[model samples]
Target: MTRPARRIARTAAAGAAVLLALSACSSQGSSAPEASGSSPSSRKLSGTVTVFAAASLKESFTALGRQFERQHPGTRVTFSFGGSDTLAASITAGAPADVFAAASTRTMALVTDREDAAGTPVTFVRNQLEIATLPGNPHKVSSLKDLTRSGLKVVLCDRTVPCGAAAREALDTAGLTLTPASYEQDVKSALTKVELKEADAAVVYRTDVKAAGDKVEGVEFPESATAVNDYPIALLKDAPHTAAAKAFIELVRSPRGLKVLSEAGFLAP
Candidate 1:
């Protein structure tokens, strides 16, 4: 089935459960979310579901995992979140994972091609590049071109990652080029360079900046239109826990999952 159809199906399957959680949270106080990466269930479902996710999805996915646990009591979800390339490499190496959620399809293709994916992958969300800089107009960095300022110390994702590919397209679209002082392996690392004031700015997802929450400010640039990237998730063919993994993927595509991801700044697939 196509990704949109998979999403619709997953939503239909998981929406009611998530909506119940939302309703419960609304009426009662929220308990601390489950340990970092676990599914939620009413009967304390006991099983280990490992997830390989992109570094960019850290905050949002972590929250989702917690909610999953709150909903399904005993399901333990372990996650390895980092650069898509790095995570893909691990899965290819026989890392026992139930689910794979990548920042880009190119990386997911690596696993799927090797018959590592359980089935055809689905695009769950879309993200675009945004420039992150110090709060306020301190540097007067207003556009993509502004990132080329003489004193600016910019950081970018290594070319192997999806964000870097998008950044390349954005720069090419603007008819301007920049020399980043460093190329980090993932968007979070690039954002970290800026957060620590090690670099003057970075190009990353709007959600990354949102995750930072006051740590850094995001500036959307028009050229980002040409550089939008898609996020794809799938169940691993060799997953130790396929049934659980499929359920988690369903949650992500479900209306409840979409609401969470959308609130975190991801565009719906």
Candidate 2:
């Protein structure tokens, strides 16, 4: 081979190697995370959030949970819906929950007092008690006094739960004392009695009656204003998924969250 030809070939090979190296460097830099200017907090999150919410929140919270999962793919939301007092007890007893959403401030105090809550509790919504009777008002039940009618099988929540306490407050405000055929441990259970026709009526949250659809009828009483329960939510100190828990709380306090709860008949706090 001639010297001139060899020199030309060597120069061309060097130029090609330099170009390939420069291209590889540019590709590596582009592949690094944060290239899009997204902060850690704004990045997509994935994990499981276990929420302990009140029985009255089952319908609304379930919807919010599904929305949260959709907004943050690869995330799971597991809920334990029941009496607020019962849920507070579970959290105080060290249950593995990321968030606690109670139907009343009293129940939330139980967690906050024990330092189980990560921060100060915030009131998200308020709920009022209502008389749930058979659909179509078959018995003509209309007011709080109607619940005291003789031969009416009425059910009330156990006094330990928020709904029960609210019912008692409403009854006291109306100056009426009536006996219930059964005392249910939770609002859902009390509502179930009327839904199943086992009881003629039940004093439960307005949201419960709304959730029952056409299965039960709701009667509004003026006394309900005196016994409105404030719902408070907080993050747990020992949350297994802290970031996911925070995100879930933010979603619950967001405008979309309030819209879902309001549509279910819950009053704004």
Candidate 3:
């Protein structure tokens, strides 16, 4: 073999090795944009998210909030659970909430109408009314009509709240006029009455009864079919923790959130 031919062959091999190295570097750089913070999920969200959710969502939302805080180590989730109407009023009055989750669209509208919501509300779950009675249903209350029995210390949600509206619709469907002994401000209050055995029964959401666990028994009534509450959640306008609030909302609509909610006796919308 000639000297020139040998030198040419050696140079060609070196150039090919350099090209392969450059190609490998380029391939790795293009495949992992996440290292450059291109993925939102890759970012660690830091800040507190103030959430105003319906009374019925206290348990499930609390679970999701903790999960969110765990996923974002530096983040904190604060919640104010109450009647949807009361929450709506607070939001409209400029409450410091990053997100709002209402039990009914009507209450959600109060926020959206006032431009307090960042966007159109999304329905996350549906709830049906159930008669929450003493453990084992000692009163033997099987239907809505039973709630109207004389001398039965029954408590009902205020007519302004979502649960109360649903109870009204259910009673209307059954053609029954129930005169509850007291009208509670929220579903939790009404359910609490039954849990403490202070009231014979209360018309509340099935999820409420489930949250109460063995403390109370849930009785499904056919009239509940006429009134199903749709829960809508949305991020608020100009949230202090905009990114965290958005992330929280996404988590609630995610499969993980759905699993927690389903186990609480809430139906998917």
Best-performing candidate as measured by lDDT:
2
Off by over 4 Å in 3: 1-40
The TM-scores, one per candidate, come to: 0.82, 0.85, 0.86
- Please give the distance, in angstroms, between residue 20's alpha carbon in candidate 1 and its true position after superposition: 41
Backbone clashes, candidate 2: 0
Report the error of model 3 at residue 5, Å: 23
Q: Quote the lDDT for 32 in model 3.
A: 80
**lDDT (0 to 1) per candidate:** 0.86, 0.92, 0.91
Candidate number of the best TM-score = 3
lDDT of 3 by residue, 1-269 (tens): 79999999999999999999999999999878746755334577899999999999999999898999999999999999999999999989988989999999999999999999998899999999899899988889988888888888999999999999989988888899988889999999999888888899999998998888899988999989899999999999968988889889889998999999999999999
For candidate 1, give the lDDT: 0.86
Per-residue lDDT of model 1, residues 1-269, tens digit only: 99999999999879888998889987665444434346433224568789999998988788888877676666877889899989999999998888989988899999988898887999999998899997664787889999998988999999899888889989999999899999999999999998898988999999899988888988989999898889999988887866567677878888999999999999988
Candidate structures ordered by lDDT, highest first = 2, 3, 1
